[model samples]
Target chain A: MARASLREDIVNAAVEQFHMFGFTAAGVKDITDAAGAPKGSFYNHFESKEALAVIALERYGATRGLAALGDTSVPPLARLRWHFEALRDENLAYGFSRGCLIGDLATEIADHSEVVRKAVQDSMQQWCDALSGTIAEAQQAGEVTKALEADTIARFVLSAWEGALVSARSDKSAKSFEAFFTVVFGVVLR
Target chain B: MARASLREDIVNAAVEQFHMFGFTAAGVKDITDAAGAPKGSFYNHFESKEALAVIALERYGATRGLAALGDTSVPPLARLRWHFEALRDENLAYGFSRGCLIGDLATEIADHSEVVRKAVQDSMQQWCDALSGTIAEAQQAGEVTKALEADTIARFVLSAWEGALVSARSDKSAKSFEAFFTVVFGVVLR
Candidate 1:
């Protein structure tokens, strides 16, 4: 029981550390320190930092609250807005110090680590799929324009949000988020 | 003359190093070695890696071909497409190994380094200003929708391109770029 608990703790700490400091900057020692475990014990649970990072990306994707996009209880457009609004609020709550972990990993370490690259790709595909499904529903209901493919819009929206996070992190302001909302919701989807 | 040339070499190499390996993962030795200069000579030209990064960002911004946006000879929308096409082609030529230096630095080191944060903000603002000008011209020529403000569209487009680069790097393909072009040019801008 203790061994399994320690492993879980390491994974949790890794998610936090990788999100905050990025994959290359954060070390096993930092993760273990945050987990209150011995640094040497990191090897017992994971084969390498690369392995741990893949797990961290998976945890991040799972916790991203993406299921809200498919709730079907609310209007599709409203559900989409709520989803991004929740993300924007989270960034603001953290003072914009933490950008999206998937984006951070994709930009910083994806080129170097094939495993990490695949993990980020999988996460992106999953996100694109979720957004695409919601968008198609919206299109069918005439809430969104059918002038373009839902999948294309989904991937573009994902990119815009990712880019907005990067801008928000740099400017430490809500200006980028505002731009994203105004253009994406006000114009593109409409 | 040698000293001046070495300083330029270091700045150029720092830009390449930061873009390829990122800020935290890259070090002074790597930049100096790439510049073919002695590692000890790094401090003689720049106060710290952070300072070098600011100068490198300036160099990157200056070379981004933003001036093309203001050239009145061609149609504004055509100029805009050409700018992004050049960037996309560059990414493909490099095998998508190097993402945008500004986006990479903005995500990786902007929060930790105030100087770099300002530099990245400046680069973003510069890019935004250039795009906003071109977009406004496109709107004036009836080439783009004027429903959303030009600056908002500009910032959103910037974010989308940055996000697309992140996607392209992770997927090692042009699909993200294709989505970006399709949505921005085919739908949003239209």
Candidate 2:
């Protein structure tokens, strides 16, 4: 159990380090130091930094509040909006310094590392699948247009949100998020 | 003239290096080595890697074929689609290995370097401005809905494209581009 705790600590620190310094810039030593573990022990916990990033990406996805989309108490569209709203609020809380780790990895590391790329692909696919279910519910409820497939719309919406987060990070403002809310909800979903 | 060529070569190589390896992963020595220039000459051409990144970003923006968005010969909406198609084809040509450098930088370096962040902001702003102009023309031609401001729609479209590129890179597929075309044209602009 103590060993498992150490492993958990390394992953927690890795998520933050990768989010802050990116995959290549944030060395294993940095992650170990942040986790308060000895540098040599990093190898015992994970095969390599790339392997740890896969774990980190999964951890990040679990915290994305995807469960909100599955809540039966709220209208589907509202649940969808709340899900993105929560994501936007979190990014804003970081002052736009930390965009989505999945997105960050997708842009920076996906090209070079097949392992990380597959992890990102899986993470986004899981998110899109959840969103597709909610969007289908909204379509059935007559709350959203059925002009497009739920899966297609979900993918595009997720992509737009990812892009908006990148813009928000670059501009250091929430204007992109507002635009996302406007067009995604007002125009696309309408 | 020879000296000027060396300076230009460093900028060109920096663009490719950054696109492939990202900002933090690609060192100054790597960029200089790729340019076939001496590592020691790197300081003579640029003040810092961040400074070189700004220039590299500008060079990258120039290659994005934004001029196609302004060709008066084509209908404004067609021009807009063609602009994105060109970008998509370029990414396909690279086998989904290289995405838009601006987006790559925005996600990876924007938070860490204000100089690179400003450069990314300017590049996206310029692209958005051009897209806004094209979208406005489409609105005036009664091809696109005028319910939303042209600038807002332009920003949203650009963000969607950026996100799609990230997805395309991660998935190693063109499905996101197809989704972008379908939604951005079929739904949002409709």
Candidate 3:
């Protein structure tokens, strides 16, 4: 493969492993093995494991945001639900063995590593911004109630969604995801 | 100090360092130094670092939950607010340098280590149960609305609180905590 494609492959593989096992636990060997790249190529592409994390986070953020945004054919509310549903399905497919990459990284490295922390933070903000913008559109379309501002609603939705993920990982069930959707979406649509 | 007291001190100190740093980043030396115990004594009290983490999590969970529960003089709603307020104060005091130990460990080890994952999950559930019971009491007393079920409300509250911590750590601001509380409490009360 080309150098750029090989580099991208490494990040994508690393992101998956990081989501499943966190940055520290998921080593360079695991990432390279998954990427189908030789060990030396990992070093050639990134300065170090931390550097790989930075790139992986950036790519993970962009891919997640784009995936959420690209489902444009669905209604705003359905699109929002779809975003979470996709996450839930993916989690279950993995046997609830994974959490959000950003959430995992934020918990693991936020206090200790400034570079990784910023990457995780920026990714979360981008997700929040995307959700907020969609909610704003829903507001304009009169699909959601006007009792709360979109930004505030966005924060609530995002935070609750993440909280539900934590619960899902712990409970080993997607029930938290379902309940979160039921309550928040129920309130929003009402 | 007696052996039991020394063990407690070691676990307490370990809790602080683990919360400020993380599992992999916080070393045995840090914990021993913080505890003012001999470095060699770490293995004496606990089988390994992982063993000590389980003890520390249990202690941290009990200490934090009891501290929150002991404030019976405050109204239930205010009691919940006080808990978050304390968290806000902690974040500010520590320069937004730490999130909850359980939260950090859940993210870091949930996928990789079943022992740590269960400890973190159990602690979170206990916290959620306590908060939920408090909210239910508040509803019965007409201190808060019954618009949503107490369990659902409690989950949302806890989740938002944890998510806010992550945001606060990332942004290096207590504003996220304040904003989250304002929005969540405002919504619940309304």
DockQ of each two-chain model: 0.84, 0.84, 0.53
TM-score of predicted chain B, candidate 3: 0.88
Candidate 3 per-residue lDDT over residues A9-63, each given as its tens digit? 8888998888777777788999999998898788787898988898888877765
Give the Å shift of residue B185 in candidate 2: 0.6
- Residues B1-190 of candidate 3 have per-residue lDDT tens digits of 4566888888889898888778887899999999988999888778988888888889888766546643667788887777777767867898887777877777676766787878877888888888888888788879887877888877767776777777777767765675577566776633
Compared with the true structure, what per-residue lDDT tens digits does model 2 show for residues A40-144?
A: 888887998899999999999999988889998999999999999999999989998889999889888888888999999999999999999999999999999
The residue-level lDDT of candidate 2 at B167 comes to: 90
Q: Rank the candidates by DockQ, best first.
A: 1, 2, 3
Which has the higher TM-score value, candidate number 1 or candidate number 3?
1
Which wins on TM-score, candidate 2 or candidate 3? 2
**Best first by lDDT, ranked:** 1, 2, 3
Better of 1 and 2 by lDDT: 1
Cα error, candidate 3, residue A136 (Å): 0.7
Docking class of 1: high
| A162 Cα displacement, candidate 3 (Å) | 1.9
Query: What are the clashing pairs of model 1?
Result: none
For residues A61-114, what per-residue lDDT tens digits would candidate 1 score against the true structure? 997778999999999999889989999999999998879999999999899999
Specify the poorest-scoring 10-residue window by lDDT in model 3 chain B: B63-72
